[model samples]
Target: MGKLTATSAKALTAPGRYSDGDGLELLIGRTGAKSWVVRVQKDGKRRDIGAGSFKKVSLAEARVKAVKIRSQIEAGIDPVAERRKARGIPSFREAAALVHAEQKKGWKNGKHTDQWINTLTAYAFPAFGDVSVAGIDAAAVRDVLAAIWLTKPETARRLRQRIRTVIDWSVGKGYREASLAWPVIDKALPKQRAKVKPHPSLPYSELLGFLFKLREKETMGRLALEALILTACRSAEVRGALWPEIDLEAKLWRIPAGRMKGGVDHTIPLCDASVAHFERMKAHKRENNDLVFPGTSKGKSLSDMTLTKLIRDMHAADLKAGGPGFMDPVQNKIATAHGFRSTFADWINEQTSFPREIREAALAHVNQNKVEAAYSRTAYLDKRRPMMEAWAAYCGGSTGGNVVQLVNKSA
Candidate 1:
């Protein structure tokens, strides 16, 4: 027969604890609201369970709740856990949003965030977006990825990784406690090993012929192609090259962090031939655009696929004319646009006695060892100066002398 008075409710607060008759406690809050709770001793150990609010739940109703909580104690069941189980499960979208927000800060760029959402929307959301997070299992994830496993193996892998990340986040945030092991449960969608396809490249003998033909058919596109071969740089790197990035007087091209694959600034030592080519390009430059090789339109750089398409057309024409087309030595098939890099690598290995490390550095490959790479930070621009000069001579069939040192006037 415990009564909670308005005065007592007003005095009680979050920091204070009080008890009513029959071992049931009436915790009065600072807002003058009261909550009924029951405290019991089971096996000489004290345990507490919240009964209900004083207004919504009458004193009699709270007594019933307290009695039910006592019964649960008698059965060795936690009443708090039972209340949680009674609540409706959260939808998958709700849990996923929580996970996404938690890990958004760790992402490096907006692109990474877009990828996260795109993967979920394309795979996870269609199946489980409306379903409860607690209801999702390993099988649901497996079905989504397995649908695209053979047709789109790389994309499937990304989807699996994204889903695993979301599930891991959900587990950490106490959303769902299911120990469902995704991607592994269905071994059919095992991570596919990336096959290293050789870059399409023309042999040294055919390379001169190819360049000669390109010179005869000299368009803006052909000039750009010549620049790509002479520099031995990636198509994107060459196409995206701005006039501002090139230092003609210094014979240097500085590729900024955003343009480079490793997200680090790189400096390329331009040979006399490359500088001459840039000088030629200056005569045809657009008034408003600063692009070293601007598109036929204006402002926009050449499309990434343009070079590849050009190479394909060149290969077809060569084949039709009974000339040696862009053929893979190993596969006996037409070489790809990207294969030029492999051709360059092969030529470097066979014709020159240059160190493999120097060639690799020229190709802008990242060194694996942190310590060794740090010590070798000069990028060997001086060493590569000769190599690049030799490469240009090899490509141009020029009987030029070896690279000479150009002393910096400031130095």
Candidate 2:
């Protein structure tokens, strides 16, 4: 065809699409809405670029716009993206929210979804939120991430990843070209010390003493720490624990997949010591809330730093008494509550004869081998009980009398 005539274009009352050659078409909506679109192949992928509606742009005007778009495509430029740039695309925060909304379904839960958006708001947005996603470069990303790189490495790492995701999404949406920022930012950041890096874990020999010191102070954070150490669960799982997830009759703490790091529901076979600790917490439980260890703010869970501060205060107290305090032997750093998981794992590896898989399962670690994971459906709850009991005994100290008996389960 030699292109569409204005009379023919106006006369066409077709309910479907009518081509005007050179990859241009007039689309008639089911509701009788008439619009123009161009189908162009770029980088071997066909993309439809929308032109103005037929009511607004005449057939001649549509042809003019389509010809310009085709020229841009021939020059290896994406006209749709250029138009978005001309119109001033969304800022980083706006784009991040779009990306966040798009990726929410794949995330483990709503809390993670909130964290994803909140972290960007708190850290990334303050610096680049107002800037267009297309305008963000490696220097901006590095500056933002480097501020917390050494101070808060974990948060900084997550922020970097999220920022990259937003930028990549913007490119996919044709808001920008493929970003050069990713490779540049990756290379610009400082390398973490791989040699000395390990979660600061107290030596197993000192764990008993640490527990004794922890027991001397009575607080919800202290109890939460105890629960974490005894059950070998994550701080989040321990802090977010609700009464519904616990079964005193069965001595199990069933952590839903939403709270677990592995995105799988985990069942912790509670040892006697952990059960006793929970019973103590129940006496002080807020009647209105379900949290096992609710914070000072009614229904809210304890902050992550609450547990950290408890450990730090204990270490300072020990030092005032002229002791080395609870220090990680390898890194010479003060032990963190998280490091207790490592301590638990070490104790299992060194002090017991349990198979590696059972220990891994207790820690809620997903198997690296996909095939084995697919076939291994068991939680090994039975095998883990004795091991946890043994751990509880060790944390209770060898002296035995120091282990606080919070409840009389037999009664």
Error of 2 at 88 (Å): 81
lDDT of 1 by residue, 16-103 (tens): 4676566577766444567677888889987556676666676667677888888888899867656646765456676677677876
Provide the lowest-lDDT 10-residue window in model 2. 402-411
Model 1 RMSD in Å is 22.4
In candidate 1, where is summed lDDT lowest over 10 consecutive residues? 402-411
**Where does model 2 exceed 4 Å of error?**
1-196, 397-411
Per-residue lDDT of candidate 2, residues 1-411 (tens digit): 437788888888868989999989998866677889888997798867777778989888888899999999999887756865787788888999889887776544455578888889999999979777766767878999888877787687668767877887888887765554454565677866565366888867688889888877567788788888888888999999999999988999899999888899999998887877777777767788999888887668989999898899899999999988998743457999999999998777656667889999889999989999999999999998898888888787222233354332110
Tell me the lDDT of candidate 1. 0.71
Top model by lDDT, which number? 2
Cα lDDT for residue 123, candidate 2: 92
Q: For each candidate, what is the lDDT?
A: 0.71, 0.81
Looking at model 1, residue 110 earns an lDDT score of 57
